[model samples]
Target: MIQEMAETLDDSGSAAPRLKQTKQNRQSQILAELNRSPSLRIADLAARLDVSTETIRRDLDELTEQGLLNRTYGGAVRPLSTEPSISERHHLLVAERERIGRAALPIIKGGRIIMIGSGSTTTHVARRIAVELRDITVITHSFGVATVLAMNPTIKVLMLPGEYHATEGANVGVHAVSFLAGFHADFAILGASGLTVDGPNEALIECGAVYSAMTMRAAETVIVADHSKFDRTFPSRYAGWQQVHHLVTDKAPSDALRAGLDANGVGLHLA
Candidate 1:
């Protein structure tokens, strides 16, 4: 029966090896998204899976609590801080990142001026922009972001001047802020170390300083983070609830936090 199934699939332009790989990949993708946002609402999971909400809720609940997720109003979401090395980050939560990257792609219109913050998620967004968006201008303090976008010749890249942070691979300090102040961008994609019900937060004082400068100059700002970051507080504060324009998180937000952001006029985009 397995042989016959493979033969049938082969006739439909998918060989056994390819078909099996595709199935494995699809499973991996779903798992990755779940890992990124363990506490995603059931409705959000159904939307992502194209299935009924009940089914998703049941399946997610059965998977033992893996520190990756926490129960929410309807489903689960990822945790705030998962310490993974660069390679590990790339390997895990891959499907979720791809979905996030795709969703963010349309926001980066061709020929528009944009600025990207540093982090694993931001780095993925930058790479996707390089492949999909064209004839644009990007100013970033992240060495990784600049390198990722450097593949495109037409897209002008500006590396902000500042002291380098080894772990973040991004620039910081007065020089970075000074360069950002001179030019305005149509959009800004940023990341945060900690997420709270109130607003975006960070751990480093220098990061807070530069992000504040970037926000002031950007016409629109988008905060990208996985759902797990919710309900956590960091040491530094960057933007208050009223300052952000949009937030792209891995899962639907809690009602209270959602209401808080809405009350502050920040649009929420749950991926």
Candidate 2:
């Protein structure tokens, strides 16, 4: 293909000089955007670049694979750092996470007994549920989620007893997992460090077991993450693509992920 393209050009000729220039310009603009803002939201980038969010995700993936950028749960950042922990993630993409939370609201209709895992995004869901719904029994390992839902007197919040991890603001230990094994929850609403076609992933090994236990007890499982988590991966994978029944995100996933979800019969909900 390279030889054919070169033969089609004169000493300094090409079929699509303008096209090459355009691609180069787009990539350059992306670099500029990242340099200016260490962490750039994929949706915001798409809007600024006048393209779809999926396009931005694709571009970011290519760049990250080439060591040009880093991927986050809801955006991209410089390659120097890993995805921010849940403690630091609340401020990164608050609006987008809130939107995802809202999108996940209606999914709780049939279930008053739900288990919410720990994360900034899941905290948003707990917030929405605290106000939007009533008279529910909520179980969780996340202190943050428990605190938020506690405000609603009508809702019964059960805290799983275990060792508290301050950074994740959640409990993760054998006790918690054992406690969760006692009930078949109506739904398991969870957040992840990253997500891929393979499954939902977690950053810390400690939480992976707890999350896996939660999913096992729940009648249904839903993963709530943003588009930035699409191609991102983490060390601990708790649930497989087949285990997730629903996915809520701020933007559409890439073609491959969507196809995988479809093949696995995973419902996709974009906020």
Candidate 3:
């Protein structure tokens, strides 16, 4: 009888720790999903995690108290001030970026020079270009983009000179912009932090200058951005809608943004 009582006590003690561990794991998962997607609805998260909406709400509450995320009306969003590093963004929205990359491929032609800007989405485009196209030259200030295209022996990569931004994994400075001015490209494939009615925006001023230079030197400008960027505005407006030739994205733009694109004659390619 004593043994049975002791065993029951032991089981109860272990159960508490196990429950705590499970909660911690669930919270970790919530953060990971938010990293992949900037915002998450409670119902969607609860459904995906196989938990009750109440439980998800509690987790969100704890995370918000810790300042990890901001709780919204019925969901949570990543902190707006915290921009994910390029490496982190590379893992986020993989499928959507891949679709955008592939859709932008038609803009590339053989024996032509293209300038690719730095961003997770642009890196995807570089990967597609390296595998599918040959006998072309790529001019880029992004170390990541240059590295991807270098794998294709037939494709020549020209690296621009500038100060390197470690987090962005790209070169940005007066030198990079000046170097771009010396040469023109058939297409400038770029990425933006946001895409609103005003235009494509960049978070970094130096990067914005590089993009602007590329657009000016290219025959046509292709902006590759995911749905997360739609209807959003950033600090620096790199180019006006009239300067952008094509926008390759995973979803349709908002009504106002679409009107702006139409007015400026920007081609919308939905991936």
| TM-score, per-candidate, Cα-based | 0.68, 0.76, 0.78
RMSD of 2: 8.0
lDDT per residue for candidate 3 within 1-271, as digits (tens), equals 0111112235446522112226778889899998887767899998987789999999999998998987755677786566677888887679989999999998665439999999999999999999999899899999999888889999989999999999899999999999987898989999998788999998788899999999999999999998777765568798999999999999887799999999999999999
Of 1 and 3, which scores higher on TM-score? 3
**Tens-digit lDDT string for candidate 2 (184-255):** 889999998777788889877778888899899998999998766777677889999899999999888888
Task: Give the range of the ten consecutive residues with the poorest summed lDDT in model 1.
Answer: 1-10
Rate residue 151 of model 3 by lDDT.
90
Tell me the lDDT of candidate 1. Answer: 0.71
Task: Score candidate 3 by TM-score against the native.
Answer: 0.78
Best prediction by TM-score: 3
Candidates arranged by lDDT, highest first: 3, 2, 1
167: Cα error in model 1, Å:
0.6
Candidates 1 and 2, the one with greater lDDT: 2
